[model samples]
Target: EEVYASQPDGFVDPDNPNHVYKLKKALYRLKQALRVWYDMLSSFLLSQDFSKGLQISQNPRGIFINQLKYALESLKKYGFESCDPVDTPMVEKSKLDEDKEGKTIDPSHYHGMIGTLLYLTASRP
Candidate 1:
């Protein structure tokens, strides 16, 4: 029921030039397509008694936020399984400066570790 008319026969095959295809779906070019699709999906969910979940932001509607699963997976992936859990990510007196005298590990691997820790801060902080 949300179908719209598109430009007529612009690229139709010459043998089938007489045929006019009716569009039954939304297209990216249409300004209202996203809104219409969202409204339609929301309406269907509501009709089935599924209430909208809490919105975490206003710029985009209907977004849900949760971090438990991500944190658990990160802990597993980083081999923290047997290690003792620390109350704080960083120690009170610990310094995190680049160790100029320490044996250098692969820059890519170090950067990857730093990236994961940085992302964890979003939830842990």
Candidate 2:
């Protein structure tokens, strides 16, 4: 399937009032493009004898791709490099709650941390 989006700011059509540029590639905003690309790539990989790894969840049909390099770099980036490894990330009784009284950290920093953790969840969840 093909998708089209508005042309760049400098590019305009004088002849066609409602003309839109044809999209030749997949874009992030297109909801189905990711799945389409994933299926296409997966099919090609399977043809080359690459087996799919474990699926992360059943409902969404998400699959996990190993990211040892990313994990290592993330650990280093978050100052967990030299820290001792633990058997579990969180304690069974531990619960995360809103710390309304705690000192507020930078919003960007917190968001970056959340983004990294979100990526980790693809494998760990």
Candidate 2 versus the native: TM-score? Answer: 0.36
Instruction: Flag regions of model 2 displaced more than 4 Å.
Output: 55-125
Model 2 local distance difference test score = 0.74
Error of 2 at 37 (Å): 3.2
**CA shift at 69, candidate 1, in angstroms?**
2.7
Question: Model 1: residues >4 Å from true position, as ranges?
Answer: 1-21, 28-32, 35-64, 81-84, 88-107, 122-125
Give the per-residue lDDT digits (tens) of candidate 1, residues 48-97.
Answer: 96655333443455555655556656567667757776698766897679
In candidate 2, what are the lDDT values of residues 1-125, reduced to their tens digit?
A: 77778766667777775788787777776897889799899999989965554443334666554656667777787778898866987778887899989997789977887898886776663
lDDT of 2 at 76: 82
TM-scores for every candidate against the unseen true structure: 0.38, 0.36
* lDDT of residue 34 for candidate 2: 88
Task: State residue 40's C-alpha deviation in candidate 2, in Å.
Answer: 3.1
Q: Rate the local accuracy (lDDT) of all candidates.
A: 0.67, 0.74
User: In model 2, what is the error at residue 17, expressed in angstroms?
Assistant: 3.1
Q: Which residue pairs in candidate 2 collide?
A: none
RMSD of every candidate to native, in Å, equals: 11.0, 14.3
